[model samples]
Target chain A: MMELFFKPKSVAVIGASKNPKKDGNIIVNNIINSDFRGEIYPVNPAADEVLGKKAYASLDDIPGEVDLVVIIIPAQMCVQAMEDCARKGVKAVIIESMGFTETGAAGKKIQDRIEAIASKAGIRVMGPNCTGIVSRDIATTFFPIKDVPRGNVVMIGQSGLLAAGMASDIVVNQSLDIHKICSIGNKCDVNENDLLEYFGNDEQTKVIAMYLESIADGGNFVKIARKVTPKKPVILLNGGRSEAGAMAAMSHTGSIASNARIVDAAIRQTGCIRADDFTELKDFAKVFSTQPLPSGNGVAVVTAAGSVGVVVSDLCAEHGLALPRFGAQTIDALKGLFPDFMPPSNPVDLWFAIEKLGMTRALEAALGAPLRDPAVDAAIVLLAGFEYTMNAVEEKVVQRIAKECGKPVIICTLVGYNRLRNRIVEELGRDLPVFTSLISGVKALSKLCEYGIRRHRFGDR
Target chain B: MVEFRPTEIHGLPGFRRRFIRTFSGIPYIDVLSHADNPAMPDSGSENFKIADPPCIENEPMPLNEIVARARRENRTVLTEIESKQILAQAGIDCTETRLARTRAEAVSVSAAFGYPVVLKISSKDITHKSDAGGVKVNLKDAAEVEAAYDGITQSALQRFPRAQIEGISVQPMARPGIEIIMGMTRDRNFGPVLMFGLGGVLVEVLQDVAFGIVPLERSDAAEMIDEIRGKKLLDGYRGQDSVDRSRLENMLLKLSAFVDANPEIAEIDMNPVFARSDGATVVDARIILRELSEAESARPVQS
Candidate 1:
């Protein structure tokens, strides 16, 4: 059923326009830009052409049968567009327009009318107001033209901006080869469960991230999420936490927002990692996608900065994440790498080593040094490519330490070198996810540790 | 071994007979669970400020006034919904409820919300209306509800003799939540001592209770909730989600606060506050309102 969306043979951009600023422009541009191999039609009569393709006056005029219709026309005209698409026998109409149900009584009336029309026609409409779906298999992105994502992590969300933002940050900023990003705005018809089920079966998609304002059709999402999370981590971020936000959520997505406390209980009961913010959603999505699930919660922080290290320690301790007491054999292994008097601690600070013995020993101590402590189940190394840390040996040392440590070793650096950052992910491979920000890196590690704790208490399931 | 001076019960000949007669069960067997007239110490600590220990404590009022008050509120017994509403003002969680002004409306509502919904005549006047046939349970459909409502109304009139018949209560038969009981009645000796216990059917039968003073914190409330043997269920044993314990703990704290705030309340009983996978919601509640007199006004309740 989901293959129809990803592998549609022909698609019609019903409200497709040449205006670069219009929502239709982005949808058309996204398709033109992607590697999607499908017949595309620009259906607008005002101009005989759109994006160099001959424009059809209406769905009735389109030369080929349209499997999907992307509509961004006015609300009054939307019902007509649906009728025309139905007459033309379009199987789906992706409405990228807003101003219905969400806008109170008048909007609800308009939306009810549209629902009736679509139901009569038997057309599976994605939304009356939504960002059309975007994917590697499809060139259709309803996001503002610029924010296209490419990665193995597929994010399905209620808020268009949230999905668009995730796509922008993951693809453009992180430079990840995201497999697909679907902005399921408003979720008038398709919801988290549908997309999650689709992602669960999608071979290309290795990880799933979702933002939900509410879950419709009961607890099916929870059951499916529980089943799929162990296969590949399903990172969840739920909005409507506050009372006012919850009430607003009902209008935002036709759901009761059904008492946030219940949502919280249900989510925890299902065993998905709950993300606190979008950064963690993306960060954890990437990390869990590539890294092996750690077997324990004990973590070792190796950093050049004392303030950052101590704060990380406090965060870990508060969250029940242990900074394990070092093992003797591990300490003995670390002694040779460290300067005199700087034997070994869980943090195993590298500031002193770099000051005296130089960058090579410091880098070795920073990366190669952390794994030596057997107490450390996982290691988080904080590095800022400053003058002392700029030596060419740092990346090489990190590479070796990560290779030796069977557990995850996440590299946290503020600076980005396209080649260096890309090289770390390539060399380290699935063992770790090198992050751009300290906050995200720390959060990912916390979730990894949380996953370990949950696994220990509840087994693999 | 260091020991204190012996008391009279300890030294008297046939001390066993006296102890058995004082604290024992039906045949006067010296059993702890059967303790009726509690050894005075069990009532409370010397410094613990309570009006009295758990007993039939009510303000002195003529039967006429009690009936009048019950009639004024249009109830047979102090109705469960009315009693709970009073508690909700002080931050208590009760089932979402609506009052029906007509019997037809009540019957229809009961049917819509599904069977097994609790139905009772609500009144601020009568205290034990359930005993007076003013309460009914688990009605299947509209006809049964209409019959039950009429039955309860007639019974209230027969028993109260003066209750001003208010509209009947049509409530969704309470969903199951972890059951806990909380109450406070003004005591003769100490003051208002709070009561906590194993709620539901166990409350009436087992009589398992733990008492504490008002205004409990999370720790104190948690301890009070766990004072009974059946509390192990809340700890998540044998493949069940942990009972909504955090909410249950809050209910305890709120109960203490409500009793402490309302000076007119002579007694308050919120029994079987059922908690489930979601949270604890109050199922049934009863409260006794005190009448103020100039003579009694010589001393207002403890500030």
Candidate 2:
């Protein structure tokens, strides 16, 4: 019954138009451009063809087996079109049109009619006010707004724009893999819980990120998020906090924000790491998708600047991540590299040695000391300038470090001609946490630490 | 005592928003502005004690004047602000409440509070009336709704008292939500410090409650909450709900704060202090601020 989305033999675009700028045309084009391994049929009243695809007068006129009927049309015509999909026995309908439910009284009535029609017909409606779903395997992006990324990061967001923004950032800014990005807008029918349930068993999905404006059903989300987060890291960027949050939730997704504290408490309890910003979402995804989850929060920061260590330790203290004092042995190991007065600590500054011993031993000492210490659970190596050469030793050291201790390592550096940031992700493949900024790197590691602790306590993934 | 006549705003001498924005705006004269109902209980409420050490050295120049002066200086201490000042002086820590009776009061109260305070009217008319104009908090008060206090207090007295009257209250409230009603009810339920959560307004909202025999301790207070039907929300559930029990325990501490502050508080009727990360404050407090006899003051602590 649900075969249309994943194994659809053919799909019909309900509001297909000849105009290139039409939302329906864009959806059709995105599917075609996505190399979707399925047949596409455009349903238009007057046109015989649309975007070089065989156009039918309507869903009933399509004749061929229409597995899924996706609509992007005006509000009034939607009910009749969905009724046609119901009549034609289309298993799934992705309504990418706006104006239903979101616009007040009139739209609410239209939305009610649509919900009733979809429910009775036993057909699932993705949304009445949504941008639809996007997948690398089959992209159904309406508006064709931005580039869809290629990798192993699956996402679900209530806002279509925010989801697209995330996808664009991941594709352009970082080297992280993108698997699936689903925008269940308005969520009239399908919501976060459904996606969580789906992604819970999704083998291909290594890490999943979500931006929930609000949860439609708190219980269902809690159940699904709990089950999924432990298995694989599910990073989230949830908004609608304040009355203590939960005010914006009404307009954004028609979700009750619950109490913001309750939401945070619930999400954190489920063993899911809630990202503070978009950068961490991709950063954590890039790191966790490839790197091993750190066993503990005890992190070591090895940077050329003392300020960097301060920044790292401050984050550690706040996030419940530990940055314990380095042992005499760990400090002594760095004594030769640093000035006499600058005694070594958890955030061991190597400004003294980088000029003398150069990258080889500085990088070695940075990775080696933290990896061996029983107290230092993880490492965040900060290197400035275009330092690809640093990665050579960093990678070699991390290889042994990861094997002996299951601690994650991150690198925050200024990427130059060598594209130092890019090379690290490619080499590690989620073997270590790598971020471009100090804040992001620390946050990602902190989240990994949080997930590690919460999962252990909850007795799940 | 009866000589303190109520002050009235004649003809709504409208305050110029533009004047507030202007640099040369001299506020020595009364710049007219509309007012509103309160979000919380009155500052002069029985529980909102003058915790600050008495202005023995510095004259207590009628705090309304001090508050008014502070408003011009952009550093006024409103009733709730002064309450906190009083509490700070007395070393009696209560839930942090921010007041906003008028723009000056709210600004003065907010200046004292960083973030997250019970935003309410400090009114005399309706003491227990939170739903009315007499009380409103958790609101971002920069929007300036002063008339709300009078509106609520008036609404309350008209609905309940009818003939009697009182002004408003704006308190920097705390959420000593793990409440055990420390007073005798006007109803048949008399004198037991009747702990309620599973039944009262809080339990209806938060869904956790209990009943203690009397003289609630941190433990007894904790135990009373065990009587709640929605104990799950209080107790840690599956990524669901959490109650900062320490905060609930602090309500007992606040009971201690009140009991410790004065010999009065013969019957404390503080219904709600919406629970947050921090401890509780008396949002809708109504203590019979009775003058104590020497013998009663000399009585041993109720431990």
Candidate 3:
């Protein structure tokens, strides 16, 4: 059903522009720039041609059957343009124009008219005030984000700018691959449950993250989410958490629960994770998409600094993960790698091991020992990958061990500078996510463990 | 030497005397004589049966008709007696209630129920009887009962001069036990959701409640009970006897079923439901029916 919107055979840009500054031009340019194997028809009344393509005056003037229509005109003209698209038998329409219900009562009247017309014609509408969609196959976003990596995480939300910003960040940082990003602005006709059902069944989507100002129908959302989350996980971050925000949410959308606790309990009962903010949402999405969920709550802290281990131990307790007492065999295995004066413990601090042996050997033994232990469900390796400390660091070996252990291995770095951080990310973050701090690393692992434990109880393989 | 807590044998003497006084057919001579050797385990902890109330066969009322009448009269909140009757008809236990119009009727009802009894002004216009000073508890004698009857009626009449007076209701005082609340409120999106929490004044101060959508299974009830922060208060706190959790779970299940069967019920507040080891009793209940929507009223009739 979503293929009509995403993988259209032909798309007609209703309001194409010749100037590069215009949103119309950027949208057409993005579609032409990406690896979209589809026909593009630019329609502009004033221009005969746009961006090296023959421009038609209207969607009716398009020569062949247009599968999807992209409208970026003024809000006043959107209803007539929608009528023209519906007459042309376009199955999907994405109205990228602003000034819908967000403006005031007058704009809301116009939006309601558009909805009635679109529903009567049986044409699916994406948004009236949105950036449209950014998919791996076809990109129609007006934003200037380039080369979003094609992978298995779909982000669909009400905020277009937030999705655009995160898309650009994920693509630039190479944190996680993006299969599809949609800004479901206003949700005049197409809402979250429709898109959730679509992506929940999409084979390309492994995990879904949403930023909901308010759910259109919370009970219906839970019903659909309960069915989808068993096979794939859904992480939602509700925005209207404060009293003022709750009041604002009433104007934004109609279905946010008055009590935040009710919404929280609903999310929990549906077997989905509720993230606190945008950063946690992105963090959870990255870890859930990249790492295999830990089978238990026992985490092994393998760090270079003992203070890092202590802080992380406290965080583990706070997050409901535990640092188990190492068995004698595991202890002996770690003791063999470290010096006699520095005995091995659950944390398996690598200070003396690196001082006596080299950095590469000490890291390899310290990281490998805990990952191989049966008692440890997950491992967090803290590396101070500075210029001098990581002179002989082997990222391939670390990544290979992480993959071979069959459990999740997350790496945190103490290297503060962006230049060195980029290098560390380039090396280790390719296979495993390299968190910037121990707190983030612990938080992600704890979430991973939470999913694993809940999956066991929910009995969803 | 072992020192037993004073609360270990609370109400025991009175309970034995009541048992002997009430039931003459049962043999109590041997059981009373063997009080010294209380270690006898011929029967498996039958003394716990003291908490069980006598079962009564209740005739189900015309709830649908009652709801329709309330809607016709444009009433949203049901009186406490009406709410408890609906609940009792649905198989949940409630205190025995009788409307007393005159002071002599109140006295006789109290004497029949074996005082001390409770009296409350019963009127459709008054939702908060206690707040209006329309409630009196522990009316120990005929003079006290007459005074309470007049006092509650006068206070209620003063609070709302135009309100119709339905006199006062005489009820047997419920036994002391754990106070817990079980209620249902209709959400705008989700139809009806059940709420459970610590009852009485602490319900507001603690704010320790858990909610679950109605039509709950046994597992959901158990989970809702366990999720509340005051769970330990019900599970025998500080050497006090624990209320039966199975009974509480059953009450939750029954309430869920009741809400599921009655869609017209907009809100049901069964606050201060005295939960005991044997069963739970609804001391006060309030059911608010959904108002008829404007759309329905505006629709043209076929006739």
Best by the DockQ measure: 3
For candidate 2, the lDDT comes to 0.58
What is the lDDT, from 0 to 100, of the residue A222 in candidate 1? 54
The regions of model 3 sitting more than 4 angstroms off are A243-257, A338-342, A388-397, A414-418, A425-427, B1-60, B110-117, B121-165, B214-219, B240-250, B253-263, B293-303
Top candidate on lDDT is: 3
TM-score, model 1, chain B versus true chain B: 0.61
Scanning candidate 3 chain A in windows of ten residues, the lowest lDDT window is A247-256
Q: Please give, for residues A1-461, the per-residue lDDT of candidate 1 as tens digits.
A: 45656678888887888888877877887877776667788888887877777787877877777787788888778888888877888777777788887777887787777778777887777766677566666746666544345457777777767556656655555545567666666566666778788788877787888787666643466567767766666788877766432222101011212244345534554557888777677678767765656777788888777788888888777666788877777677667656686667778777777776776676665556456555667888776655555453335666566666667778777554656565554444334577766666777887877776666656763
Task: Provide fnat values for all models in the order shown.
Answer: 0.00, 0.00, 0.13
In CAPRI terms, model 1 is classed as incorrect
Clashing pairs in 3: none
Q: Positional deviation of A81 in candidate 1, in angstroms?
A: 1.5
Per-residue C-alpha lDDT of model 2 across residues A357-385, encoded as one tens digit per residue: 77666767766876678887778887554
Candidate 1 stretches with Cα past 4 Å from truth are A142-150, A175-177, A244-258, A372-374, A392-396, A403-406, A413-440, A455-461, B1-303
lDDT score of residue B217 within candidate 2: 53
Writing each residue's lDDT as its tens digit, candidate 3 over B89-112 gives: 788889977655556667777888
Decoy 2 TM-score against native: 0.59
Q: How many backbone clashes does candidate 2 have?
A: 69
Taking the candidates one at a time, how many backbone clashes does each contain? 27, 69, 0
